[model samples]
Target: MRKITLSNGDTVEVECLSCALTSGLIESDGGVVIETDYLHAHQAVAYRIE
Candidate 1:
């Protein structure tokens, strides 16, 4: 897993691979299973919540 920040100053703890495959959880193969793009994630949730 890694920490990724967007231009809006929002941070997310995700696993990004090849700048395409991104996910909240790490996949079996160093790739991410993108469910929802970070562009939609709210600022409430973050790399380390509370």
Candidate 2:
């Protein structure tokens, strides 16, 4: 599994071998956008721990 830290300090775990479409909210310099990817592609999940 791979991890990606968002600008808002959120960490997401991505599976390289998964085949399922996932959805998550992303915060970028331009603004916030909803990110989605196919099941076959790498997926990212963002969530706050605290």
Candidate 3:
């Protein structure tokens, strides 16, 4: 896994291969996941981490 600190002071962990396939943003307690077209054509549930 790879880690990054967002401008909002949130930490994100991304799988190496999936990094390019996903975008993310920090939420209140966790974060939201943005899936790539290959993952979903429609808006799917955003992944959350605690």
Candidate 4:
């Protein structure tokens, strides 16, 4: 896990990029496209893909 400081001066613990994106801890351009108990999917932008 990793800890990050937000612009609002709050701290959050994150597991990984996918977890963060799925949990709404971070924002994605297209947002979450699909979510399930065992799976999650979302549209990936150019920067994210890179």
Q: For this target, which candidate reaches the highest TM-score against the unseen true structure?
A: 4
The TM-score measured for candidate 4 stands at 0.51
Q: How high is each candidate's TM-score?
A: 0.32, 0.31, 0.31, 0.51
Cα lDDT, all candidates: 0.38, 0.39, 0.41, 0.65
User: What is the full ranking by TM-score, best candidate first?
Assistant: 4, 1, 3, 2
Please, what are the lDDT tens digits per residue for candidate 3 over residues 1-50? 76755444656675642343243332323333444555523222233334
Best by lDDT: 4
Q: Sorted on lDDT, highest at the top, how do the candidates line up? A: 4, 3, 2, 1
Question: Residue 45, candidate 3: how far off, in angstroms?
Answer: 20
Pairs in clash, predicted candidate 3: none
Regions of candidate 4 where Cα sits further than 4 Å from its true position: 1-15, 45-50
**Segments of candidate 3 deviating more than 4 angstroms:** 16-50
Kindly list the per-residue Cα lDDT of model 4 for residues 19-43, writing each as its tens digit. Answer: 6777686866667787899888877
Q: Determine which window of 10 residues in candidate 4 has minimal summed lDDT.
A: 41-50
Please provide, for model 1 over 1-50, each residue's C-alpha lDDT reduced to its tens digit, 9 standing for 90 to 100. Answer: 77766434555565553232333332223222333534432322223343
Pairwise lDDT winner, candidates 2 and 4: 4
TM-score of 1: 0.32
Candidate 2 or 1, higher lDDT: 2
Per-residue error (Å), model 3, residue 31: 13
Task: Name the lDDT of candidate 1.
Answer: 0.38
